[model samples]
Target: MTRPGVSAFSVLGVCALIGLAGCFGPPAPAPTGTAAPTSTASPTASATSTASPTAPSSPSVAPTATATVPPPSSAPADPTPTGEPTFTGFPEQVARLTVYYVAIGDNGVSGPMIGCGDSLVATSTAPVRFTDQVGPSIGALLANKSRDVGLSGLVNALYQSDLTYLGGELAGSTITIYLSGQFMLGGVCDVPRAKAQLEYTAMAASGATSAEVFVNGRPIDEVLSLK
Candidate 1:
């Protein structure tokens, strides 16, 4: 007996479909030139191509110039007193004598030396004994004055004697200082004393020297002259 919907052709068609299914079941073989994916640089190469370039390095800094220092200068030396004083107007009798003198007071001060209207004067008893010759007398007097004025020591005993004798005998002698002209004390108070220095120069031939010096119309310890 024949089935109601079945046919011989339909049975043959079903067999053909099953055969086609077997043929499609397995995948086709890979291409001959291709290889399996590996954990290599392919991905990294792609990322690098996309990234930006790095910045350039900065230049090295140069050192600054140092300042130059100058050498020190040589300074001049300071001056000092030589202790050698200058004396002039020496008498021929004492050709090489250097004389200086100062007047002193009871207060240990050297002077309150007063001037006459225009001149300075100092008085003293003859300290040196004389042999009548003015040369020796003047020499002794000058030597005494020099010592009393400033010179001292045993070598200058004559000066000490002169000072002592002058102090003892002529202490009361009025000494006057003469100036070239009259001076005003002004109105300022507290003025006490002044000093005068006399210097002499000679050719070592004169027998004696006068102690008098003139300034203006006044006689000073030494004369202030224009000649």
Candidate 2:
């Protein structure tokens, strides 16, 4: 009986320690010496040990996975620039004013025109009025003359066209030239006032026989002779 009492005391002490460590709810009263534990043992021990192991393993595996992540990529390079457009060398006698033909739809007729002047007045016709210049730099002159309207559109157009025209006269062997000038007349329509820089290319070096000239899309014959 004393041995049994001593054995029960030792079991109670061990159970108290387990309860303090949160391993068990409370100590149970000792049963008969030959009796088995009413609670489970194998499953409780396995769950406690495995629970902590999986938590620490998750952190270790996470860092290893993140370390293998790929780096970001680089961007592409810029494109190369193109060379500027320019004339090789313009001849001295190429720019000038002469009586040129004015095509008005169905009928084409020759008219008196100042070499550098943009406006062409009808010599003999109805609806005779000074309107927009109908030659190269026509849009520019219109834009310049009509400061009221604003030539920003024309300036932009010329910048995009890449080619421009000026007025000139054949003086002996060389050509006498005048740069373009624009002024507002009345209060609205832009008008050409002074000589302007005109551009043209030789159809042939003959310096005679006019070649076809185009402005915007309309065609006329006023090409320059470089010779």
The per-candidate count of clashes, in order, stands at 21, 16
TM-score against truth, every candidate = 0.17, 0.18
Badly placed stretches (over 4 Å) of model 2 are 1-33, 38-120, 123-227
Name the lDDT of candidate 2: 0.32
lDDT of 2 at 64: 65
lDDT of each prediction vs. the true structure?
0.34, 0.32
Tens-place lDDT digits, model 1, residues 20-116: 9999897978886767565453888767856967656986767655445555567546656578788653333222332223333223233223333
Error of 2 at 212 (Å): 23
Worst 10 residues of 2 by lDDT: 187-196
lDDT of 1 at 124: 37
